[model samples]
Target: MNIQLKHGADRLLFGMKESDVKALYGEPDRKYKDEDKNVIYLYNDKKVRLTFYQDEEFRLGYIITANNACKVFDEKVIGEEWSAIMPKLEAKGIRAFEKENFDSVDNYFNEANWVIFQVEFGEVIRIELGATINARDEFDWKF
Candidate 1:
């Protein structure tokens, strides 16, 4: 599925409720809470993890995917080397804000939007995308 920067990926939107997700995905294969108590729903077959805020908002907030079929800007990304992917992202006017290496893993994040690419051994291994603050500096609630 295509990563819709600052919005979501697949059919999951950033501000959707837990029930909304369930309606679309049915019961998760495994569900648990993260350190922040945010509920994590895993779809092993879909190769994705969805995190919904456990706070009062209680809405879908982000997606973490290791699916090799993930796409951004309409280009397959998970297995592509930086050399091949960077140019396409740039052409789409998506510029990375920072890139840091943690031993073997490297992360490229964009603050202007809301996408992070995690790479290891020169190929993207995962992607994390979330909601973003709007131009008014307010959290975007994409219901």
Candidate 2:
């Protein structure tokens, strides 16, 4: 499947209702609620997890993916060389840069767009996409 990052989150877009997610992804491998009562759907087999928040209504808020089986921008991101992926993101007008970490490196593209790729040994291992509001602050607190 081709995953689009323009929708704030991958696969599941922002403002998508709970039912819309079920229709598109079918039943999740596992489902649970967090301490805050936010719903989380886990597709472990696909190495994907989706988190939704409910306030007035339920809507998709975050998407975390570790699998590279799907294509993004027509390129296989996971396990691909960062050198190869950087150009593709830039071609899409998404500026790419990296932050060094002790263990794994974080490559951020379009910071204003909130797209991040966690790299290890020059290969993408995880991708996080969401809105800035949904992201946790430096204090480890969510807004």
Candidate 3:
């Protein structure tokens, strides 16, 4: 998996419609609405979850991938530790982070929480990324 930060990940870019994604990955293992009411399409075999919701248009909003092969900023991040990822994030100028009091997982935020590394057992388990939409460009579609 190749993460392009707020732009999207791999061949699945942000603002992609369901048909666009389905065309790429075929059918999903499961598709349902999440607790937040966002539509979630889960591909269990690929360990990826795609979220879609309505802001202006009902389209892809976020992508969460758990593939250990996932790469971001030219580095393999999944299954990596904070000590290791910290350097990579810092080296890439992703300096802002927040370690909350929760014990389940520690999240590393890069650029206004656009891309996050959800770490558990001291290793990254999932990478959640979202698209950055500038309302000024709402009329322009990038998909």
Clashing pairs in 2: none
Segments in model 3 whose C-alpha atoms lie over 4 Å from true places: 135-142
Best candidate, TM-score? 1
lDDT of 1 by residue, 11-116 (tens): 9999999899999999999999989999999999889999888873778988999988789978999989977898899898987559988999999998877888
Clashing residue pairs in all predictions, respectively, total: 0, 0, 0
Candidates sorted by lDDT, descending order?
1, 3, 2
The residue-by-residue lDDT of candidate 2 on 63-123, one tens digit each, is: 7888768567778888888778888988887775656575557665456556677778888
Query: Using alpha carbons, what is the TM-score of model 3?
Result: 0.87
Q: Note the Cα lDDT for every prediction shown.
A: 0.88, 0.70, 0.80
Per-model TM-score on C-alpha atoms: 0.94, 0.77, 0.87
lDDT score, candidate 2 = 0.70
Please state the error at residue 120 of candidate 1 in Å.
0.6
Tens digits of per-residue lDDT, candidate 3, 1-143, equal 88887678888878888899999999999999877777789998778999887554558888889988899887998888878988887787788886653578887776553777888888888888877746594423347
| Ranking, TM-score, top scorer first | 1, 3, 2
